[model samples]
Target chain A: MDQHPTIDTRQTLETPEGTDLSLYPAGFWIRSLAYTLDWLLRIAVVVVAGIVLGASGMGQGLTLVIYFLMEWFYPVIFEVWRGGQTIGKKSLHIKVINDDGTPVTFAGSLIRNLLRVVDFLPGFYVTGIIASLCNRHFKRLGDLAAGTVVVYANSVAASPVLESVGSRPVPDGFNTDEQRFLLAFAQRSSTMSPARQAELAQVLAPAVAPGDPVLAIKQMANHIVGDRTQSAKGHLL
Target chain B: MNLEQLRIAIRPRRDWEAVDLGLRMAQQWWWPMLRVWLIITSPWLVAACVMPPEHQWLVSLCLWWCKPLFERPLLMILSQGVFGVELTTREVLRATPRLFLNQVFLSLTWRRFSFTRSMDLPVIQLEGLHGAERRDRLNVLHRIDSGPASWLTIIGVHVESFLMLACVALLGILIPEEVGAELWTWGFWGESRTGGALLILFAYIAMAVVGPLFVACGFSLYLNRRVKLEGWDIEIAFKRMAQKRGLPTVAILAIAALLQLTPPMLPSAQAQSEREAVKEEILAIKKGPDFHRMETQRVIKSTEKKEEEIDFDKGFWRALIEFLTGAGSLAAAVAGIAELLLWALVLLGIVLLILKYGSWLERFPQLLPHRRRREYRPQTLFGMEVTKESLPDDVSSAALALWQKGEQRPALALLYRASLTSLLTVGVALREGSTELECLRLAERLQQELGIPQTSIRYFSDLTRAWRRLAYGHQAPSDAEGTALCRDWAQYWPEVTRG
Candidate 1:
């Protein structure tokens, strides 16, 4: 009943300029970390600005303006100008892009950051956290309004695969995963206790063979490898 | 194809790989992951700080109970990230109000107490399945725990406890010696509820750091399972490969057509009987009361399911109304009543006919065409020609000739591939994409089982080493070394056909 079932998370988008770009969104914590980093940096900058503009009424007014500009417009200015990254976003290797994986436009940047107030409700960005958590793209209210997504700056490493020796046909009713499990079970069971082996083999017993499942699995393992070596056998090479 | 050129691979991964991928996922998404962890647990953090040590755990217990509240949002965040989608904070929060009822129901289960709950979170919060369908989906998803998710969750909880204790003890150091002594003592926690608050606060911090990882691991395992079950990875891999090759339509199109031309693995009679037997078994199960109940529940919310049952009070009135309205009208207008009744009966008969033959009727068009197997067949493997007849009859001598001619690598590959073929015939279930080490290990284990001579094992081991060296290290074997392997090949596969 999911209005949108997982339909696969690999998103493909045609950029405004008409090239296809694919991206994986950054997770909540990674983006939060970047945001936290940015927050700290901004706080430090504000503190320095406060000290520099020390107690005079004129200076106090100037500091307020500086703080307002920095607080409200920091992310917007940097995101639009610095290739969709603020200082924090850049450090964490995440960037803001349109929903279609295109570079963020100035308008997209402005709207998303502007909606930050709503996302920050009930304090500590809780509303925003909730929004990002429940959202498909981890977008806060701002990003949703602007139709932008935040994606990992770099590509994910390809899944590591066991080295391919060659194409070998698996037996009937068994898939590649079963083949992997069978092989792993067989290899690991060599050093396992008999009781443990029996316990584990019991689960696989019905599917593999009738009796002495462990032995059958082992025999199959031996058979699959075509091991001709015996404790005592002389064969022509 | 070489590793670099292979655009993408879609397949079920080993357990370690799955977990490693979880860690990889965490690294990819550390920020919002960390922030949300802190944000959700912040209340518990406050409770621990303000309340005494004794009362602090109550707060934790509460947090633990309401874990699903915290879990759903986090899962959405991670799942979206997995798919390369991003949402801002409020956007994530925006859906929470709407899903409040679902969260309450999903979070109520005892399953939440264990780490295994992490695996189930996505189904509960995301899939939008209810009642029986959710149960069935759970059955399919949780068939295997993959071991790590549950074990890690327990370990994380235990570690959090210890870390909490350590923080409490550290707090003890800041107090006066007498108070400090009291603080560190076992009864000190029991003496005051407020005393433990500090301890709980620190524990909350530790939990934030550690909790998501276990949850992420569970989530990762869940993701991996779905990937395997649904072939998501394969679909993505194929898409990537097609894109990289810039032959999106042609290559896959050709292969898809090729698949259509292949044959089914089983004979028609045997396959048909097997299919029928399976169908019968399914029918028998489906006919049972349990199956009917689950089926009904699949599409309905658990809450509304009971409403569908007959209401005894209303049932009588409805029956009375039906009986009273029909007969009196019939008496006044017999002809009209008879004509209406006849039409109703005809429509009922037509409805019954369609229901009875619905499945076959839907399938009628598909049955007209001659069918073929649609399994994907590998064309080239191990950068070598692969065919039903590619394996040599005499592996050793063939390799020996190649070695003499200074083509040592292909010679070794020939011997290795031959050994693999021999292994497959004997029932070693190696796949095409397995690495050399995996092959070596499998062969080593099976070599002992087959009881090949001790000298042959040693020699086979040496040849394996040589291949591993040449393939990965790019170091060629010396003349003497090459001749020695040439000597050993005949020993492992004694029945090698003479070239």
Candidate 2:
């Protein structure tokens, strides 16, 4: 087998390879709250209905019917109409996402909610609790069945700023195109290593420096990129 | 459009100094949590004591006629107070009883009023503290900025509270009929009514208690959800928040509501007597004097006095026994004993055979002329003379060659054939219908005809065993063992081949 230097590059890409999917345990309190809220609503509906209609067999039957309806439609109607949330979920600042991290579809929502019975397990969510404890994503039976993920609604970090060419002075020897190239380099400086930055700067030095090479290179980078003072502070070229 | 410009543009324009000043002011009022709770609860405490009987009735009547208006303020006060107080079991019990009463009243009054119509009113405002700002702060405060009480939560709490309180009242009402009237009178209004009226009243109190308890439960659930999602417990831990805040407020509101509602819910004399009888029966279990009870009391007294002495000697002996006789130690001992016995038996057998056979073997030196008197000069069947220094080449190289080529079956066949051929060449006689065992017997005959040393003949038999294993054993021998066997066989082969 021939040893190839490029093999290291391929290895680099594969070595730290992350699966696009990631699972996070749903916090204990959130699930507990959701469950408590679910029970509370179900019980409230039954009791109030029983009381109002009078605690006869008919009243009990009506309460059960109402409960069944609420159970079936509550999550579906609310999640679809209100950007993926039931009242309990909305309060928790959590939303159900698809396996690929997209908004949950109607079908996905239905599948997850419909599996509530299975998630409920022996009684009071014993199976769901065990599953959540064992799994990384804190997925209950419902989440697993539906291939859904519950995540913080706005947890993604904001992107950083990029420097522009129009804000700085051009180097003495560099032409217009070289100035533009330096700006692009500076814009990506934060992500690049110091060594890489120096290497790229050296590559551009000939075009940039006509006299007093270091000074000329510095001036050209400053001219192309804004915030000359910060550049002078050794953050980047 | 770049990040820096966007950041600058989006940065708040408010004066930091003013905001800081406001925060400083707020910080000054950061009283102890207990103080906050006391302040919130002061009004209810005062109401409970100072409010005249007439005023109490009026408030209860008002609650019945206009439940939402009365419920909201009462709940707000109680919940806020409970949230501030450090929770304790006593507080829970105190709160529970009141909630029980309130739930019953709420249930009874709910029939006369239209709950849906009240629900439609602007119970929750969408602006100010109750609005977007309040929502935002609450999100940050409770860690539930996004999730709010859904209609499901509200409805659920109400129903659950109602049912739970009803169950409790039903339990309370199940006391023997004799004491029922007295208990009802003691807890509420003294008037008696029919059995049906009493049942209705009890149900009413259950409803009252259920409502606030449900609300409290819903709030706790909401808080729990936030904690789960955001690790709100970290904040609670940091802030030294107490669990009492969660449970007590609900209990207080529930209890207060129940108390307010209980005045009208007690049963008539007959029903009261039946309920009293049940209560007596339950209490009787604890009240009776028995040997078990005396023993329990004695144990309790002894424990409380700290008079019992530790039996250290007994414990030490048990520990020592456990250490020596544990499963691991016992297994290790068994294995060590078995290994020692096995080696000793093998050594004994070798010594006994050498002593018993040596003299007899010496007498037949001429019959076995290969054996020397001075030292045992082992020899092979071929004309090649053998000594300890010189060994006959006995193994078939052809068999090894076939094995090296990965033809294990063929190699084994070659070995068997070579052994048979060697035996035949040496004038060994065998029956025509003989099996492999018969071939071994023929090899033994050839060994006797050739006057081969017993050790040399034994080596041949061992080789046969190895070949049989290689050909017919289900699992092949381990690599190291097989390699060692091959090396030993190769060393012995030169001597066997010469023989």
CAPRI class assigned to model 1: incorrect
lDDT of candidate 1?
A: 0.58
Residue-wise lDDT of candidate 1 within B355-423, one digit each (tens)? 998655433332333231112223334665443368666666778889999898888888766655555
The DockQ figures for the candidates are 0.01, 0.02
Q: Pick the candidate with the highest DockQ.
A: 2
* Shift of residue B175 alpha carbon in model 2, Å: 6.6
Top lDDT model: 1
- Give the alpha carbon lDDT tens digit for every residue of B266-340 in model 2: 224445554564355434423422112222111112343232223555678788656533346654565455456
Question: In candidate 2 chain A, what residue range of length 10 has the lowest lDDT sum?
Answer: A4-13
Determine which window of 10 residues in candidate 1 chain B has minimal summed lDDT.
B292-301
Off by over 4 Å in 1: A1-237, B1-11, B44-57, B98-100, B172-181, B244-499
Model 2 interface Cα RMSD in Å: 30.7
- Candidate 1's TM-score: 0.33
Ten residues in sequence with the least summed lDDT for candidate 1 chain A: A228-237
